[model samples]
Target: MIIADLHPGLPFFLGALVVLVTPLRYRWIPLLLTPLLGFINLMGWELGTTTELTFLGFTLNPVRVDRLSYLFGILFHIAAFLGILFSLHLKDRMQHIAGLCYAGSAIGAVFAGDLLTLFIFWELLALTSSLLIFARREPRAFRSGTRYLIFQVGSGVLLLAGTIVYFNDSSSLLFEHIGLTSTAGWLIFLAFGIKSAFPLLHNWLTDAYPEATPTGTVFLSAFTTKVAVYALARGFPGTELLIYIGVTMTCFPIFYAVIENDLRRVLAYSMINQIGFMICGIGIGTELAINGAISHAFNDVIFKSLLMMTMGAVLFRTGKINGSDLGGLYKSMPKTAAFCLIGAASISAFPLFSGFVSKSMVMAAALEEGYHWVWIGLLFASAGVFHHAGIKIPFFAFFSHDAGIRVKEAPTNMLFAMGLAALLCIGIGSYPWILYDLLPFPVSYLPFDNTHVIAQLQLLFFSALAFVWLKLSGIYPPELRSINLDFEWVYRKLVPTQFSNLVSAYQRFAEIAHRLWVYSSRRLEVAGRRLHGPDGQLSKTWMTGSMIVIVLLTLSAVLLKNLL
Candidate 1:
């Protein structure tokens, strides 16, 4: 049987069983094994084995492997392996197990031949991934995890509903080539939109990412949104709406990241911005653009994970992730500083960095597709990326003002994880063809052309110049002592206050209405008692039974005469 013919259900079922049975001390072993198994199943997989099986009258594919699916599945396994390795030191088997199952489900969804299978794995990802946040056990973590779960599971529901509509309309369950005009397609798009961090649906990312455990954040960064991006590329490629949405997504978050206090949260905004690039690539819809998107997705998972790992290590060691509280850490943590700088430079698209290779492909595709304005917007966002992630993250945390606090370097495992990710970042950057060859389409694009390289260098240098100029002028927003309100404030603060005020007004109205009702009830009861009283006109029976009998006899006689 082809690798595509291998059943995903077996792995998912076995993974959950192993997770349940495996002892806590050795849980990482099984966690590590599961992804290996998935990787084995994914590598060298033959395309187009879209088989359907009916279990208790519910159809499931068990195997739906294709080129697009294989790309996502392979990366998800890589992410899972790295994530498990990164978290091996932690004692939380619950998180480890949940994360494995979550990764498995994401891989499963990618290979799902039909919407039903997709929805199953889709909900599973939400359920399992939320456990990572809840692993912290803080009240804030609990609340944020709950909110995150609601949005995630709600997205799955929308997908399922869309699937039902799709099947009803087309009499087919296959999940392929959905359009925006149909209800099913629109629902599915919105479902993907939520997880993909489309515009207003993005607050959960920035809200909950910072609240997760240091290791948990690394896992959080890789899988969920990127899987959604893959799904969009799979199910709704070339949807024009994504172009506008992607541009908006790219531009808005820079300001937020610039003004934000928390370093992890800053990365979260930057993540959304990067997703916008991929979305734009998908929207452009050429073979080259799609390949660029898929290639970028692969590179993004590596470098983004590396960046989060560095920040996670920072939080793990110093217990300070806020920009205002952290600085001058290179004195003690040179390795961490070095890894962080690599991650920053990679994200900033520095020459011979991973981002430069993949990001340029997307930009080139955009320009080639005649999206001149979008290309310009993407260029600005590129500079802004350098400003926030490149300059703000590393400079403030590692080399800026000395806060007079000395912390040890990250633990051995943390450094190992960061090193692994950094190696991939540099390896991919130095040789773009290594990634380009793995794209869904034949590789015709070159990221190292003179024009592209010169443009990128100019952009990076200019952005750096801007950062230095602002710093020298003392005009850059100083690290704040307070948390600037983000989109979450709408739900966390503004809505709650407004809801309380509305409830108070309703309570006042209810009190007045209650008094009126009680008064009216009491008056009616009094009226009833008075009407039923013996002294009342209706209650006073005059002449009693004798008068009633005489009246009956007279009426009977008059009726008889009229009948005659």
Candidate 2:
């Protein structure tokens, strides 16, 4: 059998089983090697008829390696490898197994040739990724994992419901663009929106990610949301509503990120903000715009995971992830600090950074599509991303006041992982053509125009200058060990508190009713005893005789009146 003929994701599932059965000391062997095999298989397939399976009268395509899916598959495979390298020191077999399965499911989802197959892999992605949270083996992590699983599985449920409805209506289950012209399409759109973290449905990303284990957070940061992005780009392109929704997602997260004390949570909020740009590009639905969204997704997975891994290293070393408790770490972990700066610059879209190359595509599309108001919103969001994700994260974690916390550099394995991600950010940014070539569409946009570069620099530099001014003038909000409420307040705090209050009210009403019942019963007993008890005059013989004499007098009076 030609190895190239195997499904790209088959290697991961097979590898996960092997990792589970392998001895503890040897488990990393499968962890380190599977992605390479997966990548090899991924690259070997041509553009058509890769693999398929027939199940229950549905023509399920397990492998359809088109340009669009291929780009995502390659990116995911690379991310899986880097993730494995990052966790090489870990002996937790469950995490390794779950991580591999999670990666495999994501690959399967991307390459799935039909809605039915995609949904199958989509649900698997949720199941396997949630296990990563549980592998942390902490009570808080367990709770977060449970909540995360709800949002995830909920999305899959919606997809399944939508799929049923769609099949009933159209008698087809192709995973192509099903626009919002019918109920089925709308359900699927909402399902995609939930996973994409669109506005009100978004708290899951920020709520559960920080509570995961450090390494788990790195994997958590990369795959799930981006997969949603892929689905949206494919399914809801030019849907118009996405543009407004994306704008809202972009602007809302920055405020929460600014006030957030947990550095990991800050990154989580920033993840939504980054996705907003992609959503907007998809909304534009032009070749250039869609290209921008895909390339940005690619860039986001790398840099976002890089920052997450860096923070994971910090948490691993210091046993703290809050910004209020961390500072001056550059003194000890210079390598990590440097790598973090690269990730920051890349995220900030500084010239010759990966973000600079990709994000520009979206902004330019917004302008060319006559979305001037939307363009303005995106520009402001761009600066806001730099303010919080780019500046706030690094400044507070590495360069703020000396907190007297000293720790060694990140582990060699971790440093290796971070190095790989950092290199990609710089590499892709410096040479846009290499990434552009991988885009689903041919490259037409240029990143290095004198006018465009100058404007971007001015915008970013001014944003940085504003941050410095605020810090020096004592206007910037100080990081505090306090929770900043977001949409999660609706569920985590408000709903629970309201339910508790309702229970209290019910108890009070029940107490009052019980007392009233007792009082009424006592009154009835007293009244009954006064009328018929043995001590009463009416109950005795004298009362009977008195009643007879009164009846005789009444009869005599009635006879006299009749005679008159």
Give per-residue CA lDDT, model 1, range 122-170, as digits (tens). 9988988899899989999999999999999999999999999998999
| lDDT (0 to 1) per candidate | 0.85, 0.91
Give candidate 2's TM-score.
Answer: 0.95
Query: Model 2, stretches more than 4 Å misplaced?
Result: 50-52, 532-564
What lDDT is reached at residue 233 by model 2? Answer: 87
**Tens digits of per-residue lDDT for model 2 on 374-488?**
9999999999999998998888889899888998899999999999999999999999898899898899888999978999999999999999999999999999889987878
> Which residue window of length 10 is worst by lDDT in model 2?
536-545
Estimated TM-score for each candidate? 0.90, 0.95
| Candidate 1: regions farther than 4 A off | 1-16, 56-59, 517-564
Which candidate's lDDT is highest?
Answer: 2
Prediction 2 global C-alpha lDDT: 0.91
Error of 2 at 308 (Å): 0.7
